[model samples]
Target: MKRILCTTALTVGALIAALGLPAGAAQADSTPRIDLRVLVVSDGGPSTDAIAAELDTAGTPYTEIDLTAADRPVIDAELLADTVDGRPRAKYQAVVLPSDNPFAANSTEMAALVAYEQTYGIPQVDAYTYARPEAGLQYPDYSGSLDGVRAEVTDAGRAGPFGYLDGSVPFEDNSPSVGESYAYLAQPAAGADFTAYVDAAVPGTSQRGSLVGEYRHDGRRELVVTFVYNQYQQQFRLLARGIVEWMTGGVHLGASRNYFAVHVDDVFAADDRWNSELNCTPGDVDCPDGAGTPDPIRMVPDDVDHAVDWQEDHDFTLDMAYNGAGSVDHREDHNGVDHLTDKLVADRSRFRWINHTYTHAFLGCEQDTTVVPWRCATETDGSVRWVGRTAVVDEIATNRAWGESVGLPLENDELVTGEHSGLKVLPQQPDDNPNLAPALTDTGIAWLASDNSRDPRQRQVGPATTVPRYPMNVFYNAGRAAEQVDEYNWIYTSRAQGGSGICEDYPETSTCLAEPLDTATGYAEYIVPLETATALGHVLSNDPKPHFIHQSNLAEDRIAYPVLNGVLDGYDALFAANTPVVNLRMKAIGTELQRRAAWQGALRDGRVTAYRVGGTVTVEAPDGVAVTATMPTGTTLAGTAFGEAYAGERSGWTPSHGAPLTLALPSSAAQATGTAEPASATDPAPATRVPEGTREYTAAH
Candidate 1:
């Protein structure tokens, strides 16, 4: 029997009970259970006061298990699953490392955490973890201090966590700094409204403030730094709760493609910050200014550019799909898939090639046993297949082979998805191929592609029923929802397969693309037909759907989703013309004037509607009156909060209207199509029902 460790004595309820502030009505403990414990790998101040206050109010008990804490809470190596002795310490939920050493050093024993994660299922966060990425050093050039306005009342009765960082969150290299990070906080446990603690840059600083590292691992959140949290306390109280609630369960992969996942397959071919000079001219070497560096011009329809001719003209970043096959025609010179042991590069630009595989082996399929070389074996349809563990292991070994093929040497930091340079990317939905998942782990591939067999919905309905797949493929939606309701699309997957889609008969699923647009004249796949679906109530309101166009998938959509994206741009123009923007990038829409107003009016009347995930909560007040609120089911509040909408200036908006998917958009045609729709009632019935085998995947949507 597994033993349950007792709660840390530092918990808010225990703290509140110890405080003895009471009445005839005793306050219930509101601390939530899905524990979010933080372990400061590197010691020092990031100021946990703000976050702690918010968590306390929200009744979320988080233990600060400082690996470097002077008076650190007792933790066990066993607690950490470290071979070294330390038992009592394993009592918390997740372990958070704020600095470099904590993440890199103790993380030296990574297998321990892997075991712990496998056994206890605890997620560990490595926030702002150090180790010179460029120089491959242990720290940055030096340390920097973050400044902020001292609050009038420290722990203002608040709930949840939220904040912004105009100033830095001071920390030494490899040090764990605790600072306020949530956008708002509402201590529902106490009867107080909310608090806006972390807000605004002091009188002056520099350009825009930024967040260093923030991410969720294994469904557990590990905030590397708190650039912005509790900036506006009460007014945005609900938002604060929403942020923390989101953080608590790790980062929940949202329901749709808006949760874009960019592949950080190779180090930035440029400096850092996920940007690359791969777009730079051959010898010019005049690296584009970071700001001037276009937000990756994604060729919706990708194509291979043997040289810089087209890329230089369009200012597009060229992707050298490192292939062994191409090598057959080209040997050491030819560079396409045939052997995993060998592959090719794009001359000097080969530095930018994303290492998917030496040969594009869609890991889940089967290969011929009798064939001497795996590549020689093909399914009856001429599809390359692989089904053995040895081949999978060979696939894993290919990473090292590719690394050797290229010049990159692997390191520990390489494993952690490099704090994913982009925040809007959202969290990855678990893995689809469990075997692939292990291979990814074995080869340090945190991000892998899900073989979405052209459902277009990116859904996985059924092993028993319709069990949604994890880390479901987020298909690049080129345009707005208003434009793509019911469109018949010939999705481009493997160019070798002539971009299979609804019309084509696939070998595995048998079904083809059948995503319904819910149009008046039934469902259709034409652009005009699909765009017309929105008017028919399938998509109410003129507001565009929350669509995400990742830097990678943009290559595919450019080709297959030309019309959808082109038309969506038109809808974008229309929606922005309307003041209150309903759905868009949440961060971009958070304006200063609005942020100020929300900050000024904390715990507002009608403006704030409260909700949370766990049944528990913690609250505290100036009077020392603490109250805890508990609910059985989780929470949600419909309707908008920023009040009236703003049809901001739409002068610059220009819709990119083009011919539908039938016509190929240049560039993107080269990259494989990335998303797949779910099997539908509309698809022609298959000859064979999918055989029941072992199957499991989390519902990411």
Candidate 2:
């Protein structure tokens, strides 16, 4: 098997095979390791068989993109390119071929396959069938009638050796050879290794069925297992499995991550927030909410719309973190459910718990035109009031205490405030910001959601006018207001990203003036973004990305995200690749921060040097070019060597001390020299080119 070479944690290959993985080794519950993608290739055949064989042996799961699954082949080709969804197959450690025709039989089909491959950069196996009858073989095509066949140990050794046996084998489900097998004609390319071991051969035909070879595609490894029907006499399956494992980098992360939010505010008592199904509840005979109803699989549809309504739904509990004083018996208990403690015990995985408050408050102080309306705020003192510092701390404590009760540390719960009243939506000034850093620190909260796409040059918070609560698991207003009772039926219930007023379409509950789409579309996209983000988040965590909300979210009866779902549907196309399609969970972010912090700490300790170039930062841990790739390109990455690449374009800093106020870009660019390395302590250049350079400055390493 190909060995992984990295200085981080033990290479996964060595770790898993060495002594198996410790349960706690990869036990962190949040992470997705791959850059997942999917490609719906041709119908099944040998190429498909070869790919499936590798995936099965490696134990990697991928999404399948079958055009036949659609009534009409109208899927977006972009998402289908080496990806069923937005995730890329190449991102995975290993991937399987969707069909035998590795390349299209004609120019049109070839173009499609190439495009798909461009999107995904993982090793793929080709069964004898990938050779298109019409298109000449792109790789070495091997096919021959069975001739000389015999099993034997290898004698090719010339020096010290590992006890590797030599023999021909067959796969578990081997069928008659349907076509010819192909390999990259280049065989072993530069900076890559390839080998073709031959066990037996037929006259004037194919051999090396169980042989191993290596190739490279865009700096990634590709292992080729030539499958000539007569290549081996025995042990073909073993050889194939080994090759598959090697091709996929032989590493497996986690399975998947599902994201969703359950509202838990004042509207626990539902009125119209459900589907209007005609006689589906209450009455004994004709109106029974039974399991085998019309939509048997869908537990709760529009008709059975109730918070945590199981009449026709799955086992899901809506989140209930609000102003109930954490005690159901308290008069201030806006939520009847014992939200603090018992809620987690009832169902920890049922729904996502977003932080509203020990008590809730209206966000932004804006009046909802709908007479007596609902805002982010909740009832306290019998009326809505600003949930300032005390409320924030109380909310954090209550949520943390509840999570601890359920065996789920509040550490995993990223705090998200609901009453954007003005925070998540607008760029709150230090004076305007209701929850200042002092309050935030007091709450010990780790996460926060934004309401709008401000200057795009923001970190703590900036110009965004409103929260882009779309594609989100929770929306504050869904449980509020009596007129929009239909809100409960949908998983996503907020205005579009940066949409308009509480009632305006783009900016309102209708369309959310802040973003695209009307209420329905906004709501739908919101649902999609959650699953998508969760999946993406998992990847960031290097954990298994959860399968999207497959079966109508546990108890939340919201329909799934469609457009975004379709975009994500393709993620499954690379099941064989052991791809890590995950989301950017707070835990993963924290871990990454910890890693970088340690690395930076070492730099400060004179153990290494760090440099910030274009969109990437290079951490030279005494070794040259050890790790350097694109980082999260947000506004925060502007001043430090790690974040300077992203900051070069923003207008925040003014150059000083002979150091030109500019980005370290290519010499061809204006005011750039393509030589922007972090200056030594004695160097006169400034530490960073970020706006607040003085605040973010550091001594040269």
Candidate 3:
């Protein structure tokens, strides 16, 4: 079992005695204590699971005490317990009550929980049932017959957590008698303040009552709602997140941020040869030398424009990795390149420009000095020799300059390597080009993209911070052969088809296929499902890296745009409409990671672990590094050592390096606040530089 080093409200002497530490020892090994964690009292219902999943996605620390089908004895004993691992179990700053019956008023478990809430003023969330005679528990005045009912937000609820709510929900389902019941039927006590109310057909009709309410008993506060926790419903999920944030006091954590991005690679001129073909026959006129290749595959102006328009329509931000040298065949004054850049620059709000490289320089290639074209140096190992540092700088500087000249203003210190093939160093001569670091650093490039499928060591070669991108979807390599096409289809289609041996012809016209058949060449497959799968993959893995695609995917006639649209649509259904899956650029994501990397747990001098337990976030940065904290709502700054409020959240002034920081909230605020730490006083740095040779690399768009 993993041991949790705990520091509770108990004194150090008491903790030492409990843990059998040396009596005279100065202190423990400075391993930071878990200041606080959210406690969940659940009955293992789907609703509880939904809430837990949200917390997990947010990276919130929580411990669940499963009481599913347990009697009062088991539930009461657990709640009454004072300590676990020599730390007070009651130290949980916030408690979640997903089940109405588990902690319903007057039950033995409920009594213990109520005592804890009253004493510590810990914020609690009560879903569905509250005080009720039907369940043999009664507190204030909660009374109602159990049923389904529709609700409307009251003027008061609009100012509370349910502010996003609008219209009668579950618009598809409605009760024959009650019209539409977006919520479960429940009644609020007399003292409870209603945020929402069940509406009657007429203004003063009978059936109208409280649907959502906040109850303050003595010093305890609980948000009571009648709706089930359904993650698929956007409103429910939004409300749940809002409720949690409100309870904690809107404390977004640096490490716990949900990260997202979408990078479109090879933002150059469209391939004129791209076409919708169906088959590759031996003697077919279109099949040149029987090699199944895309014909007339170039992206026309409409294709690029349509893609940009679609993304704009959805309000989706995209990262465009521009190759300054344009296509190899059309490098000298490519009108397509100019047109594409002009269009992209015109809609700067929807695109983040990235440096792909001046020429798509594969650093693995040792330039063939004798040849007029770029060529690789094939040494004895079948691998190209290392290109020197100067070559690296020229590639970066040239591309950035070109992008800026074209008004793209490519993000400085951020790059997506051409072909997603990052810098390579041969195994035999690992120490050959130590200059790659200084080269990238010199050009102000600090972030690089990598594929998750590659070996970690192979991907970690370059000096820049590596951002891992999903390697599931095809970027530009649409295979032009029978075998490659079948293999591609097998990966995505096989799951629904059971296996891929259903089609015999080059362009299999079978109904069992999951993708649409691309007639231009059977090799070109509609990868809408594949795109969706990639998005789902990143979400489940809890990796916030954006889903990546090549410029080919956006070609008007090809399968990429449709696939991308379908993927985004699926996200809307699963999450919320027009939600920014990841709104940050490559550089911003990199900086956030760096800030989080500086602190380990809540220890060290660089960054302190601030916990939002009561009113104030106790910042424990003894070696103060400008600790910033959100001021709790309904509270004002007190005259203490806590510094200025630069960006809304109270932040400490930059003191000399080793000064200690200890923030104390006003007594009233502490009594009323939840577990959310307040906002940061200092704004995040605009961009972060990887200090020389750090091996850290964040996944990019």
| Superposed Cα deviation of residue 207, candidate 2 (Å) | 16
TM-score of each: 0.26, 0.34, 0.60
Model 2 residue 275 CA deviation in Å: 8.7
By lDDT: ranked, best first: 3, 2, 1
Worst 10 residues of 3 by lDDT: 692-701
Evaluated with lDDT, which candidate comes out highest?
3
Q: After best superposition, candidate 1 residue 480: deviation in angstroms?
A: 24
Per-residue lDDT, model 3, residue 502, is 43
Arrange candidates by TM-score, descending: 3, 2, 1
* Candidate 1 vs 2: which has more lDDT: 2
Query: What's model 3's overall lDDT?
Result: 0.48
- In model 1, the runs with Cα more than 4 Å from the true position are 1-354, 365-386, 407-441, 452-701
Q: List candidate 2 stretches off by more than 4 Å.
A: 2-356, 363-387, 394-409, 412-414, 419-422, 426-434, 446-553, 556-585, 593-701
Candidate 3 per-residue C-alpha lDDT over 1-701 given as tens digits, one digit per residue, 9 for 90 to 100: 00011213545465344434455532422222223445666766556656556555444445566665343224432333233223332445567777444654567667666655554456676654544433222242223322332345555554444333443432223124653223434344444443332221212345455445555544556666554544443334434554555455444232222245678777763432322243232222223443555442344456656766777776777788877676433535554345554555576555778888877665544545443223456779876566677887788898888777767755688887665543443332333345567777788777877655442322334557766666545535442333334445553344455344445333444434646344345543344454555465454333555557666556644555555566566555443222235567876665544433333232222233334333434444435333333342233434444443322233223332443333455554543333234333221111111122111111220
Predicted candidate 2 versus true structure: per-residue lDDT over 1-701, tens digit per residue: 23321112333333323322343433321111123111223244444443443332222333343333433232233323221121111223343443234433565544444433333233444433232211122343344433223433233310001112223222222224433232222123324344434333432555333234444343333334344432221234324434433433322211112232323333111211222243121211223333123321222223123433441133333333333333333324544443333543454444444444443343333333222222333356644344466555665566556445555424433444544433534322212345444456665544444433231211443211111222234322222122122343321234433311344423333332223334445444444443454433322222221222222232343443332343234333211122222333333433333333343343334443222222122222333212212222132323543222211111111212222122232223211111223222221221211111111111111
What lDDT is obtained when candidate 2 is compared to the true structure? 0.32
Going through the candidates in order, what is the number of backbone clashes in each?
Answer: 124, 114, 32
Give the TM-score comparing model 3 with the true structure, all chains together.
0.60
Local accuracy by lDDT, each model: 0.27, 0.32, 0.48
